[model samples]
Target: MTRILVTGGAGYIGSIATHMLLEAGYEVSVLDDLSTGHKDAIDTRARFVEGSILDSDALTAALSNCSAVMHFAGKSLVGESVEKPDLYMQVNVEGSTKLLDAMKVAGIKDIVFSSSAATYGQPGDAPISEQSPTKPTNPYGVTKLKVDELLASRAVTDGIAAVSLRYFNVAGALQTSDGWLAERHNPETHLIPNIFKATPSAPLQVFGTDWPTPDNTCIRDYVHVLDLIDGHISALSIMKPGTYQVLNLGSGSGYSVREVIDTASRVAGRVMPSVDVARRAGDPAVLVASIEKAKKVLNWSPKRDLNQIMQDVVSSGA
Candidate 1:
């Protein structure tokens, strides 16, 4: 079996992807610091090492003999990144450098990095494509874009092949026995999860209703976690040497903040809350994906829709 090392394999998307990797007959090992990832999400079939990417010793041990590394560990909150830019750089940029160094030393030529759509930072149009200009407005996006540049440069100089899968809003749970890898950050900011948890009596807070879109709220492309994982695997399996590619992963449709809340209310069988708040700084009107490259390259199409996303997420009881 091909040996794959998944960083942050116990976290939300990482854990689900690890399970899929194991199911596909690969020998999977997870390296996580448990900072935001849960230990229980790990599958018993795969080996687990409790470590962070910052620790070179731990990374070296986990990466040894691994055929490829699927990097998913990082600080991902945009709001938090604005507040703590240093933390984002430490984990996303510096930690990624350490992993790349270790991969070089170990001669691991394949890498599938977990990038974000935040890298686009309010592009000129909807359905953002790979060619879209990446002028990230926030530190979180800036760091991811920087890492993508580093990986591409490394791929050119070295023989390492890397593909950065830029994901939009990843929602829903893994189709597993373990409860859905729910969002449980210190300050939970995602729309779907927060809407699900809100009581009918309490109004759900909607940010920025003065944007140029149909609804003043921000618009985003939502991809089920399963589809996101599948995209990662597809990228890793098909990537050729001397190539560094960046692909956007999301359902080709966009949903506004109000649309998401309404859908969640229906799925949860409860009246959800609504509270229109001030527009957040740097909030873009619409952030959707153009998955033409993904469909052509990976031969992948998202099987789940927004309703499915809401249903699966509510069923997970996260």
Candidate 2:
């Protein structure tokens, strides 16, 4: 079995990726600090190294005997990134630089990164493609864009095989032999989870109701965690040495805040409470990915829709 190192394999998406990689007959090693991930979410079968990507020693230890890496460890909150730009730069940019440096030392040539659609920032009404302008508005998006640039440069200089899967709003969960690997973010900044968590006492805050969107709310494209991982695996299989590729992984469609609320209400058979508040500091008015590149390159498309995402989140009791 090919050994792959999964950074941040204890978080929502990383944990699911670890489980799926193991099930697909690959030897997996997970490196996570549990700073924002739960320890119990890790699969016991794979080796777990409790550490952060910022630590060079941890990166070396985790990269032992690994042929490739699936990079997912980073600080990823838009609001928080706006507050702490320097921290985002440190963890997302500097830490990734360390990972790339360590990969050079370990003779690892392949990497699949968990990039975000935030790199597109605020674009035109059309769905964002890999060729779109990457003028990120927030510090978080800026850091991701910087990493993508770094990977592109390294691909040419070091002959590193790199795939940066730029994801939109990812939702839903996966059930493994262990349990459901669901979104357990503290403060729950995501829309789908916050929608389910809404209540009358402390209603969910709907950020930016005055956007240019049709529904006057921020619009985002969401993909299931399962589908996202499938794209990653496909990327891993088709990596070409001395090449860097970036693909958008999303449903190729979008849903507004109100639309999601209405959908959740229908799915749950009750009104999900929410309140409209001021716009968030670094959020784009709309961010939907054009996954045509992903389809052509990875031969993959998302199978789940918004309703299914809502249903699955509900099923997971998130």
TM-score for predicted model 1 compared with the true structure: 0.96
User: How many pairs collide in each candidate, listed in order?
Assistant: 4, 0
Q: Which has the greatest lDDT?
A: 2
Candidate 2: where is the Cα deviation over 4 Å? 208-212
lDDT of 1 by residue, 1-318 (tens): 799999998788888888999888899989999998889888888889899999999999899779999999999888889899999999999999999998899889899999989888889877899999999999999999999999999998987899999999999886666546655565677888888767657667888888888876788899998888888888877877888999889998999998898888788877687888898777778889999999999989899999998888877875
Error of 1 at 125 (Å): 1.6
Candidate 1 residues lying further than 4 Å off, grouped into runs, are 200-202
Per-residue accuracy of model 2 over 7-103 as CA lDDT, tens digit each: 9999999999999999999999999999899999999988999998999999999999999999999999988998999999999999999999999
| Per-model TM against the reference | 0.96, 0.96
Candidate 1 local accuracy as lDDT?
0.88
Whole-structure CA lDDT of model 2: 0.91
Compute the lDDT of residue 84 as modeled in candidate 2: 98
Worst 10 residues of 1 by lDDT: 177-186
